[model samples]
Target: MVLLDGLADEGSETVVKPVRFRIGREGVAESVGVDVGWFTARGYGELEPDGLLRLSPVEALYLTKYGRVAVEDDSGHVMGFEELFSRLAEKTANLWRDYVIYMDLRNRRYVVKEGFSPHLRFRVFERGTYPESAAKYLIIPVYEGDDVVVEELLEYVRACRAMNKTAVVAVVDRRNEIVYYTVSLVNLINP
Candidate 1:
């Protein structure tokens, strides 16, 4: 259980109380201190006239001093939080795939093939059954567009670097029915 104090009011000493709570089966508990100016910062819950901290339950769940969960879009959509995240992830993956394809085409090392489910796969140079090495694996999906993808890509790069593998990321820009691709080395061989 962890409790974070709201911003302190003018001339008032900020006091943070501790509490315990569980988020998606993970137990988290800690205490945090808040100064008058820092506690009153925007995006945080505010105190009420009655001296009780006023906070939206949803907002509380989404933002706090410890960690924050993403807030759903303001659109009055009917989909649940999990469903929205899933849809976002799918779209991001498609973008990444498109970017990879564009890069392959530009590099002339890969061609359009019709046998795969995604309708694309990188053709690595050198034959002999493609050695069981990390170099042989190209075009790993890192993310779709959400923060999850960013975190996953970071973790993937870290893991790959730990194993002495190079991590590459391809970016695609789509505008006015045109797709452009850019390839960049994500990081060196160091986790």
Candidate 2:
């Protein structure tokens, strides 16, 4: 994947990068070029039955951090952000009566809340549905004048660590005025 320091004013609004290999498939026991140990230590793995790797809805949502839409499977299939949001909204529409999305304009941090106040603290339970295993906050950093403000990012990581949940951060480089994408996973016991 091409990595850029920042995005250009024109071109694609959202970029999708494809993965090269399937996780858990024959001859693909490890995450391709990615550090599998981070994911494995956190209990995430491939869907053996379908030959698909399951990204936490939180991680999937984080792909939008870099103005990217979604991360593709080994097959090069791209799933858009709107589609992901629609699917989640559909699944939990009946259970939750309201939805609140938070985006910090200063830092570009975003969080989605369904049937809960933004101030309430929560923990995610892996292997469950949205709101069940969903990260309380989705943090993204947009390069401001000189440095990156990471308050929200730290908060999310801290929350995930305290709850023994996996924290995945998608880092986008926009230095070249061209958009580039990549993902990073950090296992936090206490951020």
Candidate 3:
């Protein structure tokens, strides 16, 4: 539900600027199609003290593609979902899988963002909370059919533990359904 008009750009990326943009205060950034509530509710962005909603690139792309934000270049050109998405994807390690996990968590009403333990892409704050509290969980995305390295997963748990957050893996199926599991080091001792 976003409106596109008069957005043009010039940059090295050749796609109307780089993956990130220089959205003008009012001249460049249009009133978004989705209200600030849409981003706040999904834990994607925040309305700053200046009344401008600051968003992460991940949130911007996800919302632009699926949620309710529309993006255009500086010259009034409509930016398609795939068009923007492709640009964002170039910056991530596993773009498709990560985005799928991000959207899934957001759709479930949890406030999530991209600041978790290293190697993990998200820090899921408790429900109904947004930027006011510390994150509670760290989530790493993995496909059900993919080979998982247990040692690597253990490291994530250790790092999250040190940071006072729980570590979980979001296992995605072929149908894009997700299931979560905590990764931990199981100490074994003979009785």
Candidate 4:
């Protein structure tokens, strides 16, 4: 509620100056100002080893939608929400699904980042733990009609377990509603 209120401050007189970000030819969005640390401090982008604030497509879109950042093409042309979304989505698989879950989690005050592995969609940190601690949850998004491969899922769960994190499967229905399930490996026979 508080997060939503902050995001949807229609009546607030305070105008937030959007930080400018440039989307390069390689499809990565990088900030162009001193707000790099500011964005990273608030859990919006990752501070790369090269000292650049690199934003995932989902993160850039979310920040753009919230008016916290302005995204432009490599040629300095400003992009609207649809244009940016379309361009970025072309490079990301299941873009809409990932955006929905990312927005939901962010609105709920969770610090979310791109997953470390291919099988994971996101790594979610509890409120106030980001930039200092590891994520507590590893999230994988599953659409309603997707085939559930038990062995693959088990592998992902085991990866999360090895990292001391909870593995969460976020099921996105046709209507875009999400439900989360915590998955764990259970040995049927005693070792």
TM-score for each predicted model, relative to the true structure = 0.26, 0.27, 0.69, 0.88
Model 2 ranges off by over 4 Å: 1-33, 36-55, 65-69, 73-76, 93-191
- Residue range 30-82, candidate 4, lDDT tens digits: 87755465566667777877777888989988988988778989789888889
Candidate topping TM-score: 4
Error of 2 at 21 (Å): 11
Candidate rank order under TM-score: 4, 3, 2, 1
Model 4 spans with C-alpha error above 4 angstroms: 1-13, 189-191
Best model number under lDDT: 4
- Cα lDDT tens digits for candidate 1, 35-102: 32233333233454543333332223322322332223335233343443344444334533443443
For lDDT, candidate 2 versus 3, the one ahead is 3
Model 3's lDDT to the true fold?
A: 0.65
Please say which candidate is ahead in lDDT: 2 or 4: 4
Question: For every model in order, what is the number of clashing pairs?
Answer: 10, 7, 11, 0
Looking at model 1, the pairs that clash are: 1-19, 1-20, 1-29, 1-30, 2-29, 2-30, 7-39, 7-40, 92-144, 93-144
Look at candidate 2 and give me any clashing residue pairs: 4-173, 5-173, 5-174, 5-175, 6-173, 6-174, 6-175
> Which digits, one per residue and each the tens of the lDDT, describe model 2 over residues 1-191?
33342322223455444332222222122223443333333333333344344543433443333443334445655446564455444444311111211211112222232212222222223333433355533323232243644665566556655654544432323341212122234668886
Cα lDDT listed for each candidate: 0.34, 0.35, 0.65, 0.83
* TM-score for predicted model 1 compared with the true structure: 0.26
Question: What C-alpha lDDT, on a 0 to 100 scale, does residue 54 get in candidate 3?
Answer: 65
On residues 86-127, what C-alpha lDDT tens digit does candidate 3 reach at each position?
A: 655555557677778888887777888776433787889898
